[model samples]
Target: MKIGVYSYFIKNQARIFTALVLTGILSVSSGLTLIKDARAASANLSLETSSDVSKDNTKSNRLPRPVANAVLQDLASREGISTRELKITNYNQQTWSNGCLELPQPDEACTEALVSGWRVVVSNGRENWIYHTDSNGRSLRLASANTPSNQLPTSIKNAVLQAASKRLQQPISQLTIVESQQQTWRNGCLELANPDEFCTQALVPGWRVVVSGRQQTLVYHTNQTGSVVRLNQKPNQSTLTPVTIPVSELPPPLDRDVVFRQISSGGFAGTTYETVLLRNGQLIRVRIGDANDSERSVRRVSVQQVRQFLRSLERYKFTQFRNLSYPAPGGAADYITYTLTSQKNTVQYNDISQNNLPSNLQVVVKAWNQITASAQ
Candidate 1:
């Protein structure tokens, strides 16, 4: 009886130990399931919470409101969530369609506006509005225009942007300004890949200092001296300034009746001058003379300027010159073409085109040595 009781106690203890081990395995499996479920739920919530502005079609529904909302509802149902949270607060989305937006509210830092057709979105930061277009104005990822004010000297930025814009045939509207920093002119010079001499020559005409953003995109214009300017890619340089010359300083039209006095020792001596003595329509005293002329008359005047003096003369007159061939100096089988202006006996031989002549023919000037004499 004593041996049987001891064996029964040992058997009971073994059974109890086995039961505890099984319970622990079941508990671990249950905890794993709970953890997986919680993670799955969190992932679903995150996916549904993202904004409907994705450009990728796989991520969200098409635009134009009703469709987007329907797609949102479908997504919510699949995730076992209520549609109430998915309701778009601002479906008007005028800011998303047109590139127009008011200044950011007190708490907000920046406002984004979508530029139609470009897929480009512009963000208006504290100081300036940045564009989302790429170097060529093709649609590109949205980016900011912020540069620490101290980084690039405003001068470097301005020059690079203006040069790039002119080179790329792109409007400032399409450039995305990424990073801008202060840089010395020497450090920022770009080595052009194609080396277009004509385009490069225009890089900094007249003393223009350019302010550019990170991509060397032009943002503003200034003079070489670094005065703030307001020119926006104007080909004509005159339009950039503010000073308007009043008409008071202009010289009055020369009076045909008043004989002009000649200074004996001036730059005008000995030269024949054509002046508008009585320019009542192209009829000027065609025989005006400089101070040195044996016959002294009025001093020489520009034909165009004279027309400007008397507008009526412009209609009656036109410029004419004569092109003719002349004998060559060397007497070889060669001749030169000369152009004689209507008023002057002087002949000018153009030297530029002689190289392009055929091998059999050579070009030379006949009376070129006598140009000064001809004028006399």
Candidate 2:
């Protein structure tokens, strides 16, 4: 849908991403336990440095430069502001069914053939605007929002980011926002007051922000203005509003050539996301646990590459992780527990021990992360 004037027709694959998920809250319980500790996360300093530089470039990446520049100039001209004052929050590639990009002007005649273009979401940190354009943006159209939405929703997004940056003691540029959901808490503690902490006994409207850093992810809860921010360390659910937004399940594989499947959940929001990779190198992702997730994404890679990966799994004795439930240690909170499924064998682990996981499990996580990044 559009943000300001016009809209692009979205495809079905775009709908595949918003689906179901869940979690297992295993602590010091009297049950089967297989706890794993995390190793330090590795990083390529050069890549990280270069990546940050691109954000400042403000001229490329997912949104083509021509389209982005055109959208910027048009919005700036219309709003009577500088192009620098505008930002593009989102952009997605699209294949329109008609020359009009599926949005024709009143009584206008248009060609009836498929066309490739983009649906761009631009904002001035106030109202969001959507612009549709051809591949190179030689043609453009602006449409109003389908359901009007504030670009930053009262700037709470920034407030929570700052809070999380302070909490992690990391540079703000190094952090990524995974998700933000509007919520009403049962208490003033944002439903995460510790046993020893004091909290007001009344409902409070706020937001749940999921922030991701190089080695960790966390939840920051805040009021409308983000003036009262809290780390959600102990989520209290009894009186809290059910924050789960119902989503569809991932579509089944075309065949039974399954390689492995992974399901992850647990943040302050306590929602699940899933992914699956087939032997033919068809990777499908749904309800991803990362920032700015789409409904779903699918990518096809070299079958030889997938075969090589399976061989690597064999080298690591993949079956050794079967039925292993890598337990979460005591006092762990906001950790995303990951479960791996292959054939009849199932293994579970969590973000707490992601980097230090068993080689068999580690390979799967690392490979899938890479695949997901490339798909993005």
Candidate 3:
């Protein structure tokens, strides 16, 4: 009877241990299943949130109201200008590649892979500032005017006013001095044509006086001795006389029916990248490297956007910037060339700095850069 009882106890104890072990295994499996489900639910929620934000962005065309306000505050702080004085003239949306951050490298060719952002143009009456922001309204860059300003002596200011009044055929009282800044005379003499005995081979210190009248403004340069030397004369004086050129005599008007070809190339290698704007308003960008490698990208733009682009070109007077050149001397110096074509005409310009571009041409180039950066 004692031996039988011991055997029974041992058998029951083994069964109980097996049952506990099985239960623990089941518990661990259930816990793992719960963890997996929780992870999936979290992931789904995150995806839904991201989709909603994208939908909201797609539905909105205008910049968020807060963005403008934030930009105003930031720009005023950086430029030391009053917010009230700054006017937001233009706002544009575009894909902003991080390429510009890589200074001295030709901007990476614009591609669909780049991030989207905004470009805002602001003005403080006398100068314009370009501000770039990411989609989140964070400032990326603020390109403020870099024009230099130097105060003039009271005597020098008076002399400049007198000279400006005579040249503009306006009384001293009618003319108001808008600005006076020091300039280095690059030419040998301050005289418009004939050099005085004081003219030297070395650069001479001078003053630039801007006098404004009700109808027009006159720019004058004065030597250190306060003698008026040169006037900001109109270019191509011979062509100043208004003579009507018959349409038949003029080059055929550009083919406005459709965009033919728009190509822009720039970089250290002379042609590091090329962007082609198509008739359908799509952009095809190609990055040229060594013989073995090249990258390409395509971006689609709206018909309305393309039409507006053509309209913007209307403001450009091809004649004004024609024959003008800003030479870059060194082999590795940066250069940009724009070649635009239509059925009727093809025009091209190359320059080292857009700042040296004519006023109207500068506007055109600015618009082009903004469009290419965003669309490509």
Estimate the Cα RMSD of every predicted model relative to the unseen true structure. 26.9, 37.1, 20.2
In the range 228-332, model 2's lDDT, one tens digit per residue, is 888876543321211111123223333366676878778788887787877667788788556767767788766656645654554454554445455566687
Q: Return the candidate ranking by lDDT, descending.
A: 2, 3, 1
Q: Compose the digit string of candidate 3's lDDT tens values, residues 108-176.
A: 233334667778888877767676776666545554322213445556667867877787788888766
> What TM-score goes with each of the models?
0.20, 0.30, 0.33
Q: Candidate 1's residue-wise lDDT over 1-376, tens digit each? A: 9899999999999999999999999999999999999999999887776533344653332234343444345423322234554443222112233232222211133335544322222111212112232122333221222222323344544555556667666665544333222222211122122233332323332233333322332333333334323334432232111111123522233343322111111122332334222222232323244345555333344333332322211121111011122223233333333332222112222233444322112211222122222221
Regions more than 4 Å wrong, model 3: 57-162, 166-186, 192-196, 202-376
Per-model CA lDDT versus the true structure? 0.33, 0.65, 0.59
Tell me the RMSD of model 3 versus the true structure.
20.2
Pairing residues by index, what is the TM-score of model 3? Answer: 0.33
TM-score for candidate 2:
0.30
**Which candidate model has the greater lDDT, 1 or 3?**
3
Candidate 2: lDDT of 270? 86
| Model 1 alpha-carbon drift over 4 Å, by segment | 51-376
